[model samples]
Target chain A: MSATVHIADVVKHYGKVEAVKGASFDLAEGEMVALIGHNGAGKTTLMKMMLGLIRPSRGTIAVLGENPAAGEFSARRRLGYLPENVAFDAALTGRETQAFYSRLKREPVKDALALLDVVGLGHAVKRRVDTYSKGMRQRLGLAQALIGRPRVLLLDEPTTGLDPELRQTFYDVIQKLAAEGTTVLLSSHALTELEERAGRVIIMNRGLKVADGTLDELRRIARLPTRIRIKVADLPPSGSPAWLPTATPYRRINGHIVEIDAAPDEKLDLLRRATADGSAVQDLELIPPSLDELYAHFLRQAERPQ
Target chain B: MNALITIAAKEIQQAIRNRWVLAATLLLAGLALSLTFLGSAPTGTVGARALDVVIVSLSSLTIFLIPLIALLISHDAIVGDMERGTMLLLLSYPVARWQVLLGKFLGHLAVLAFATCLGYGAAAVALLITGSSFDGEGFAAFAAMIGSSVLLGAVFVAIGYLVSAVVRDRGTAAGLCIGLWLMLVLIYDMALLGLLVLDQGRNISGGVLSALLLLNPADAYRLFNLTGFANVSLFSGMAGLAASSTLSVQALLTALVLWTLVPLACATLAFSRREL
Candidate 1:
């Protein structure tokens, strides 16, 4: 597939402050790529640069082979953006707002109600935006973005106020859009939320890109230690057989709990030895690290001195 | 072109829904009606005739109402969007910045046009009912005056958009627009009068006076329309100067066009560079 978004050493600054420092990435077509970063990590700033709202201080960013800051309407015509906090004119009702955007895009107004229905806002279609709850407004925003069935969709903090069910619905819609060959770029601090939905993830910290890859690829690169917690009825003395040599073992979060991290091969050996010793291994668990841990670990590494 | 019209339609929808705007429009219309009724009453004096009264009220309103409405309508066009975070959504579309500015100006002009015609039309009907001298020329003069008022309002609509684009907040946009109105309509005219008086004894017929008139849209509009009002020959001297030296169909058209162009150009430029 062709690359839909290409950023080569893009840097953006606000006065003396560098908002996005030497950022670079490429997103292939039909990909749902999540951008994970903390607040003030330049995630929104980078998104603005991609949308051509702000010119980069240096370097190049091409969204569908066109520079955003060049005021290239051809590229924007195929693009859809959902801002972090969606706001519409309070004077207009939901349908009016949707129809306004539809008209701006030169699209038929018939699909607006359908989009609103998909976002579960069909019942309140005639209510003014000021009367909408935060989540409802976000749904309307999503509907607006989906108006023309754009080629590339940019969603910022899309799931902030959504409940689990609505969040699942949002992911389903995104997956459907991706299935139709649209490139999806999602930026949010919800790493766990994205971990399950995104085909790939790009991590940013301190105005710089820290890592980018699939979930497994990021796991391989970070090489972060896995953590397992077990519950025991009794305590073993420190530095005894209770602590496996091949693994790094630690004491309980609770008095009866023990936690350990071991290599793949040694993991079974450690569990076998614990049972073989006739010690009460009432419960055991083998846990892999999650994307949040990986993200935090990489962000720390990025902040560390070379 | 369709996109520009779409934007204008949306702006009109928004302005119509503004309660403050509706209230202000109703109040102004009421004032126009009441002034005509009072002016048609038996004056019992020489200078208090119906035509004189109608001209006084209409001209005074022209000095204040047109610019005030234009500023109120457009002073928040851009800055309000920025504050509400809606500008990002609009800019993300495939529209140009100038298209947005022009669309907004047209929208505000539509509102001003509707309000002006309604107010002045009511005044005309009230004068006719009171058995005032409602001749064809009188009606023609009133139309010309209202035409000038609308064009003048359009100039300030552009100016208000520029102020909106420059400021980051609604309050500041409003403050700047009103300040600009005060300077151009009130203080700038006064200062020009002071200068003309200071040069009263000298032979000072030059481009300096024409350039000064161009500096104030309100003054330029007054010169354009105030020439026909009797007893207003005090201003007719400056009007004559502008008409003889720099005023023509082409020059007046150019002046009106520049009134739309200059502020709109600044607004679009500012909007292009704004982070939103």
Candidate 2:
């Protein structure tokens, strides 16, 4: 598949500080990628570069086959961006704000206003933006970004002020857009929220991209142990099972339940041994490494002295 | 072109909603009506046309009031949007940076023009309603005063944009705009007068004085509307100064136009290079 957004060795320098340091990545069409990073990890800076708000100190960025920072970049109409802590003219009503953006995007005002309903902001269409809550304003921001059916959407900390239900609605809209072949690159500190939705993740720390892959690929690369919990009718007298594999250590949770950490390669062997006879094992549970754990592991790995 | 109009329309809508249009119009109308009645009272005794006196009074008013209004509306144009985080999202669209700056300039200019016409136009209408007699020269001068007033306001608006583009924050821009107003409208003339007094006839020639007057937009505006017409100049006591000075009407207008364009161009250059 063709890359919808390309960044090659892009670096941003604000004086002596390096916001993004020689980072390179390409997002394919219809790919939903989560950019997870800390506060100063260059996430917003990277997104701004993609939107052409700031020029890179080095390298190049091509979005939809055009230089976004060029004076007459024709691809800008096909791009949408929602800034972190998005703001609007307080004097303007929700409908007017939508219409203004629609005109700038050269889209139909009728169609753009329809997005307000999709984002659950139809109820406050006539109200001034200052009267809307933070979440409502965020929804309005999202509505504007959805205008013109942009092929590339860059959202920086989009869900910062959204409630759980609103966040669900936001992701639903994003998923629908992505499924329709829109490339999405969103940055957020909320890892659990993106764990299930994003097909791929890019982890950045201290101005560098530490990891990028699907969840399973990251798991294979990190080699982090999976956890297995066994609930038997009873444990042996010594609180250890005789049939359990001895290579990996096991911890007893209670009289009937015991948990063991199995390496990626040894998970099947450990599971088979635990349920071999079916007489000792009453029930079994398997837990893979979580996004939170993977994020932490990758950050730690990137911080290590090389 | 469409994007430019969209942005400009948004600005006009905001100004209307925020009551900037009403406040500016009301302020100009109130002051103008007062000056028209009070300042034109001596017209009968002085044997000058009532409309000519009104033109002189309103031109002086424009020198002070119009610049302040322009600066007040424009000082925060660029930095304010940047602080509000709207400029980021706005620039992300297909619109160019210069388009944003120029669109806003046009919008604010339109607001200023509307207010100047209606407010100052009210004063002229009041004169006609009061049964004051005036010739075509006086009427033409009155029309020129309103037009030049808007041009003066445009000069300050462009200057405000320059300050807005250069400053890091809104507070700084506000403070700088006030300082600029005081310098150009109040201080520059005082300092120039002092320089002329000190020089007597030793070194500062008429050409140098004309250059100095052209350097400040307020002074250029003052020279244009006050002295450009014979009737208004005779009534305002600027006929002698207008004759002695070598600066022509076209020169003053050119100076005002350059004042608007130079700073506007500088502001666009500055904003295009700005990080956020």
lDDT of 2 by residue, B101-210 (tens): 99999999999999999999999999999989868878889888999999999999999999999999999999999999999999999999999999997999899999
User: Considering every candidate listed, which one attains the maximal DockQ?
Assistant: 2
Evaluated at residue A183, the lDDT of candidate 2 is 96
Q: What's the C-alpha lDDT at position A185 in model 2? A: 92
Each prediction's RMSD to truth: 3.2, 1.1
lDDT of 2 at B98: 93
lDDT of 2 by residue, A1-306 (tens): 789899999999999999998789999999999999999999999988888889999999999887777765678888888999999999999999999999998999999999999999999999999999999999999999999898988999999868999999999999999999999999988989999999999999988999999999999999999999999886875846887756669888867888888899988988888788568888889899999999999988988876
Q: Summarize candidate 1's per-residue lDDT along B184-255 as a digit string, tens digits.
A: 889997897798899993855667777777677876676656555543333234445544655544455468
lDDT value, residue A240 of candidate 1: 36
Model 2, which residues run further than 4 Å from truth? none
Candidate 2 collision pairs: none
Global lDDT of each candidate: 0.81, 0.92
